[model samples]
Target: MSGSAVRSLVSALLLMVLLAAAGCAGGKKEPETLTVFAAASLTESFGTLGKAFEKSHPGVTVKFNFGGSSTLAQQIVQGAPADVFAAASPATMKQSGAPSPRIFARNRLEIAVPKGNPAHVAALKDLANPAVKVALCAEQVPCGAAAVKALAAGGVTVKPVTQEQDVKAALSKVRLGEVDAALVYRTDVKAAAGAVEGIEFPEADKAINDYPIAAVPKTAHLVLAREFIDLVLSDQGRRVLTDAGFTAV
Candidate 1:
């Protein structure tokens, strides 16, 4: 064909391609996002549950905000835009002002020491020794509250070198060798992937923490929130939680 004919054909093809691309873009629907505010200890289990939820429900995305339950509750109470809230304790869920919270699992504190147990830490009372550097969660958080009760039950007093805002933060101190040990949830120690080892004590039984989950009352995605909570309370969810060292409630 002549040069002008060839140029005209190329221009027509380009226009057709642009129209097709625009049509595709216009036809696509944005995936709906379900925002879950969960305690830091639920990171691995909830992550797996979120993936399963997404796989089962097409065109939906699961987003998570993991932190101290108390902090997450405060964020939700301040209207940070959350669909669901799963707290390490019912108190935190109540603090979030999210109604109809349900207990799904339970957890207990354990002494997390470095893999080698360099400080020769073995029991809750060992934390009281001035020679042992211990990390702990802040008193406002569930893990910290449980720690206090457990320590009390054991008649032990500890002076922590650093108090973190969450269980994961406290556990990190032990994993990083920043402290000789940390009082964290059993699940947290299990999630450490061998970076730290857990030492169970009788006092932990006296301070078991109940985990609660709820659909945020002000959530725009209430349906998704409830469904996620349902998944968390389901048999499959129990298996996941149990494998992660949480006790099924």
Candidate 2:
């Protein structure tokens, strides 16, 4: 009835309307997340790629599950929720049941030693020396399979002090001085950088592993999954992978 009363009522209604609009906007702002399952050897490169993808695609978040290729592949096969699968080996990819996989990169095994090469491991054969404690990836992992092939090519047989589940774990043994040396991917040794030194062996060429990537058929976000895979196969992704020591496929 009064002018001041009417003005107060109008202000209350306007505040309620603004609050309602804010609620609606908040409800509509849901982030898009893309889940990627990748090999442990790809940790560094894929981490960089994921961040880059997030920056380039606003409102999209990239999440990665990095582990041994065999382990990751098995996880995918067991109905794990993943939008994409990036494996370190075709064998693992095939086991994962991810269709239409494309080889994105290649990697070879290298002997990784402590930063100072305390054990003075000079070659692959040296790993066979009973005095040198060595670590290797388990037979199930891609790196382990490569290591076995490389050792056979070099006519060397090593009894590793420990067999790790992944290349990174094997490398970690060298870094922590738990083992005098370990066989891991060149990319992994590069990722370890100053923490470990990579020793290139002639036999490594015989056991190069191909890294493949594919989108999961049951991906909830098909478009985003495809886009992420495309980005990984792009020039920028190649640059990142190369920087991390992966050879382009």
Candidate 3:
């Protein structure tokens, strides 16, 4: 009785090992790795959506390189090997040669001031005060272009001590109290929460910035790239972005 039981146990163990090896060889191809270069402004929302995408496509690892839109675009053009690039503004996407980039969302400029708006910059025109240190995005980026347009519409010229490379950087000046105010997107001020308060300017609408997303043309993982881009335009993605203060496009 003892010999038979031992033989049966050994045979079962051998079979189990063989099955495990087979599973390893045949299991759904390991999740593909998709790298994304996204604008810093999308940090919170994309972080949420990336998790959802990973859940839906089990085994797929989503890695993000969040930075200034123009910077990210330059990296892509210089061959950063990202699967996808999502910019805070369409003008940035153009820098990466992302032809036909889809406008997935839109944002409008707002005046971001120190918490409680100590300066009480009630209107856009107030930004021109010589006493106030204003921060602005460089005109090369979409937000900066929008800021210029908005100022022109208001018939005032802004003199920011520094022209930041991105909206977040410009906003950072205000957040750090280095500047009295900054022209950034409403979504950014919202994301900052208590750090900054957003003041809506009537001229913002005429210069709204469109956020665009595109599958990087140099992507080696085009399948996964397209998949992630589709996810960005999907209903679930829209919900996340909208909740983050973006207007879905």
lDDT of 3 by residue, 1-249 (tens): 699999999999999999999999998886578898988778888899899889988898899998778888888888887888998777788889976688888888899999877787999999889988899988877678889999999998888899988777888999899998999888889899778988998999789878889888867888888888888899988888899999996
Candidate 3 whole-model C-alpha lDDT, 0 to 1? 0.87
| Per-residue lDDT value at 121 in model 1 | 93
Instruction: Give the alpha carbon lDDT tens digit for every residue of 1-249 in model 2.
Output: 999999999999999999999999877547889999999998999999999989988888998999998998888889999999999899999999989999999998889999889899999999999999999999999999999999999999899889999988899888899999999998988888688998999999999999999998699998989989998899998999999999986
List clashing residue pairs in candidate 3.
31-59
Q: Positional deviation of 161 in candidate 2, in angstroms?
A: 0.9
**Model 2, C-alpha of 197: deviation from truth (Å):** 1.2
The lDDT per prediction is 0.94, 0.91, 0.87
On the 0 to 100 scale, the lDDT of residue 241 in model 2 is 90
The parts of candidate 1 lying over 4 Å away from their true place are: 1-30
| Candidate 1 residue lDDT tens string, 75-163 | 98888989999999988999999988899999999899999999999888899999999999999999999999999999999999999
lDDT head-to-head 2 vs 3, winner: 2
TM-score of 3: 0.87
How well does candidate 1 match the true structure in TM-score terms? Answer: 0.88
